[model samples]
Target: MAPTHSDHHHHNDGKKPPPKLLTLPTILTIGRVAAVPLLVATFYVDSWWGPNATTVIFLAAAITDWLDGYLARKMKQGTAFGAFLDPVADKLMVAATLVLLCTKPFEAGVFGQAPWLLTVPAITIIGREITMSAVREWAASQDGKLSEAIAVNNLGKWKTATQMTALTILLATRDGSLIGEGTLLASGVVLLYISAWLSAWSLVVYMRKIWKVLLM
Candidate 1:
């Protein structure tokens, strides 16, 4: 039977309120976290069951990240836990994939020649996330101001979208399908380079914003 809105709404209302443990966004964030193991499994489950499947799974996981945020905002169900966990889940998933994609065994077969080339863009994306996360934490501790405007940026969202698209294409190309191997790999590489530029630009912008605050 389908659960009614009222039933779902009150499901976690009974809990105490500081952290607000079980909001819809938190549930979505948890879903993203849960997907990481599946992503890892896709790479290691034998050549017959390789990155082709993993690419689709990872894309679905990325979609959940966006869906949860939209639903939370639309339904007014956002929570502090969601805020904390969502970005962490995204970071962990991206970082893990980057590491896996650069290493031997998996990297050799899946990404083909010069697997380490992927790391240039991977580092750009991951570095921005880490730097921004640290800056936000430092500001919150020192000034007790943790505004959404301060933490979220449009360029950051664009970077995620582009990065995910690129990764999915690259992963799918691992199957060596003619179309995937040729055009898709080229496209993914182009997208990745664009994402890296965006990530770097956004990082500078975020740092400048925080710097302004600190100077004042």
Candidate 2:
């Protein structure tokens, strides 16, 4: 009875695809992605660098997360390529750190090593990221502007802040920068679990919003 939005997009031509990838904002995003391997390598490899190296590098990279977005807006260089690459880099960093935390687990006395609890949060965070990416792609294919309906919201920002803070603190546990080991590592785990909870809540919110639009 009704043509889908996908049918309408086929006839449209106004919105432009991303231009060349030479923009400063795009370069910053690319740099963020590039640092991911070094982040993981230093964290596990240990011998190559000092104890707190991962924490310092991670927090530095996290700063770029905000800087790139701010520059993209201030510099007027918000290309589709930057939009896509930014989140991909963030998710890559989060996933790598989560794997390390899960493998190591939280070190509580009676509880011993509880890798499964760490794993639950990792799955929750990664699964939500994957689901939202697919939704955005499909919505864009339907109507180029529709995907913005579920773009990064405030809740997503909180989730990311908690994620970055927790991951950085966890990595810092290798040294007593902020009094690590029991105190800092435990706090990091608690914050991470909180971020994971927020991640699930945000996922539900986005899915509901998109579902209503999809059915229309």
Tell me the lDDT of model 1 at 93: 83
| lDDT string, candidate 2, 43-139, tens digits | 7764635446777778877999899899999988898889888889888988887887677654553347675867888999988888878877787
Off by over 4 Å in 1: 1-20, 104-115, 144-151, 178-180
Instruction: Find the 10 residues in a row with the least total lDDT in model 1.
Output: 102-111
Scored by CA lDDT, what does every candidate get?
0.76, 0.80
Evaluated against the true structure, the overall lDDT of model 2 is 0.80
**Best TM-score goes to which candidate?**
2
TM-score of each: 0.79, 0.81
